[model samples]
Target: MNRIEKRLEELKQENKKAFITYTTAGLPDLQTTAKLIFAQEEAGADILEIGVPFSDPVADGPVIQNASYQAIQKGATLTKIFDMVEGVRKEKCEVPIVFMMYYNTVYHYGLEAFVTRCIECGVDGLIIPDLPFEEQGELKAVLAKNEASPILIQLVSPVSKQRVPMLLENARGFVYCVSQMGVTGKGANFHKDIREYLAAVKKESAIPVMVGFGIRTAKDIEPFEDIVDGAIVGSNLLRILEESNYSVDAVKEYVSGFKKELNENK
Candidate 1:
């Protein structure tokens, strides 16, 4: 198993839910972004989702959009991001790093080249927000050939009712269960049938099912913590990054709170 599969399995075996966190790469700057990785990991983040700066982010909310814009404006190119990731790995950041980006970026970067670079930099997974379930064939084929392949995670929303099975049929890593049918950020409501949807997904999926979108606090996830394998905190974490003024200490203090809350709730 790759780092992601192994990490999620370890969590499952330990009977503990995951605490996934996200931040845009090169936000504030690449150096600060690298510092944030270990901060989140130190804060008990099980999986680290790094948002790649993109010109057009179809699935992002205002918080992430602004962060991406800032990163791009500050010259956060993919090459720089990859170089930073390699450097971070060399420094021994153990948490699994997943890149959350658009398919257009992957396409422009060239699929094989992107996968090759990901292997070189130690990326453990990918979340392509706009990649349709039907079109994962080519990407999957590319990933299967490489050693320590970076998983291509599949996403499902409450609206993806009938497609859940199809999406999970050959899915790797984990399924990113979108909490509602909307763009990502805090302050959004869970889907009306979110509980049932999650239960159904868990029943159908062989891998772990982790929820994202609109989740700001452990309280927001308390009700569904039993139903999900983990919870991803993105916009909430980004908002912290904004409030913390990119301070690693602030990120750790705020992020570490989730582990306490999640464990206390358990």
Candidate 2:
């Protein structure tokens, strides 16, 4: 199993929920972004989802879109993000890093080339939002050959019950279960349907299911603790990074609060 799969399995065995933290790469600056990642680890983040900014982020909301623009303005690219991961590895950090990017960036870099770079840089997995199951053949082959798992995003709507099985079929890393029907950062409450959605996904997927989008606080995640394996807080965390005065200690403390909440429930 890849690092992502192994981590999820270990979390499952330990009866704990995984804390997946998201941050835009090269936001503010590359060095600062790296510091933020390390701060996340210090705050007890189980896995790091490094956001690769793209020009047209259709899946994202205002917060992430703004983050992407800021990172792009700072010249964050696939190459720079990989270098950041390499720098982190050089520092001897073992936390699993997954590149959360749009499909266009991968296309621009070439799927095989990107996969090769990820393996070399020690990227544990990938989360490409725009790449659908039908079009993932070549990239999937490349990932399998390199032993890099691609975590598929499972967007669960009211009509998604029938589609859940197909989404779970070839998914290796944990399934990114989108919490709501809309784009990222909408901040919707977890309704009764979310429980039904989780049950449906769990019935179809053997791997762990992690919910993201609109999840802001530990309270937002409490409802999912019984059904899903983890919660991904993106916009709220990114907002913290954006508003903070570049205090790594403050960031660490903020993340530790969320981590503590997740652990306390476990």
Candidate 3:
């Protein structure tokens, strides 16, 4: 199995939910980003989603947008991010790393080249928020060439309920189940029908169903219970890193608390 599948299966065997953490690569700077990546893994994060800073992050909220802007100003190129991943790998961090980026970034980098670099840098999956299922064919081709290649993760949005079966069928790695309809940030109240939506996704998904977008705290994780296999926290973690001036200690403390919250049911 690929890293993503292996990690999730391991979690399943242990009867534990995953705590996936997202942060923009080269935020503050690449050096700090490298430190944060390792720190998150050390602090109980099951997986890592390192975002490629884009010129226009349409799917991102205020916190991630600001972090992206800072990363751009600090010369956060895709090449630099790859180097950071390689650096982390050299230290023997076996945790799965996934890149959360836009389609344009992959297109600009050349799809084949991008996928090759992902394999080289030890990235296990991709989460292109804007890449529709219909258009994933090209990238999927490259991913199929290698058994351990980075898989293009599938997404299940509120409006895509009708397509859940098809989406799950085509899914690799895990299913990214969006928590709400809005951009990525702290969401106070989920839609009343969220439980039903998650239930449908769980029924159809052959792989783990991981909820993202607006998952901020332990309270946010409580409602997911058996509905989801994991949670992805992006904006709130970015906000915490910014607030802590990119302190690794701050990231570790936050992740420790978040993991505690996630495992309370276990």
Model 3: ten consecutive residues of lowest lDDT = 186-195
Q: Give the per-residue lDDT of model 2 (tens digit) for 1-266.
A: 66777877888899988889888898889999888888888778889989999998888899999999988998988898899899998998778888888888888899788878887788887787777767878777777774454444444454577778887776677888887776888886554588888878877887888888888877786765788888888888888877876679877987898878877856
Q: lDDT for every model?
A: 0.89, 0.81, 0.88
Cα-based TM-score, every candidate = 0.97, 0.94, 0.97
* Candidate 1 Cα lDDT to native: 0.89
Model 3: residue 4 alpha-carbon error in angstroms: 1.3
Query: Higher-TM-score candidate among 2 and 3?
Result: 3
Of the candidates shown, which would achieve the greatest lDDT relative to the real structure? 1
The deviation in Å at residue 32 for candidate 1 is: 0.5
Q: What digit string (tens of lDDT, one per residue) describes model 1 on residues 169-217? A: 9888889999988798847599889999999999999999999999888
Candidate 3 residue-pair clash tally: 0
**In model 1, which residue pairs have backbone atoms overlapping below 3 Å?**
none
TM-score comparison, 1 vs 2, better candidate: 1
Summarize candidate 3's per-residue lDDT along 90-115 as a digit string, tens digits: 99988899999999999999988888
Cα lDDT, model 2, residue 24: 86
Q: What is the lDDT of candidate 3?
A: 0.88
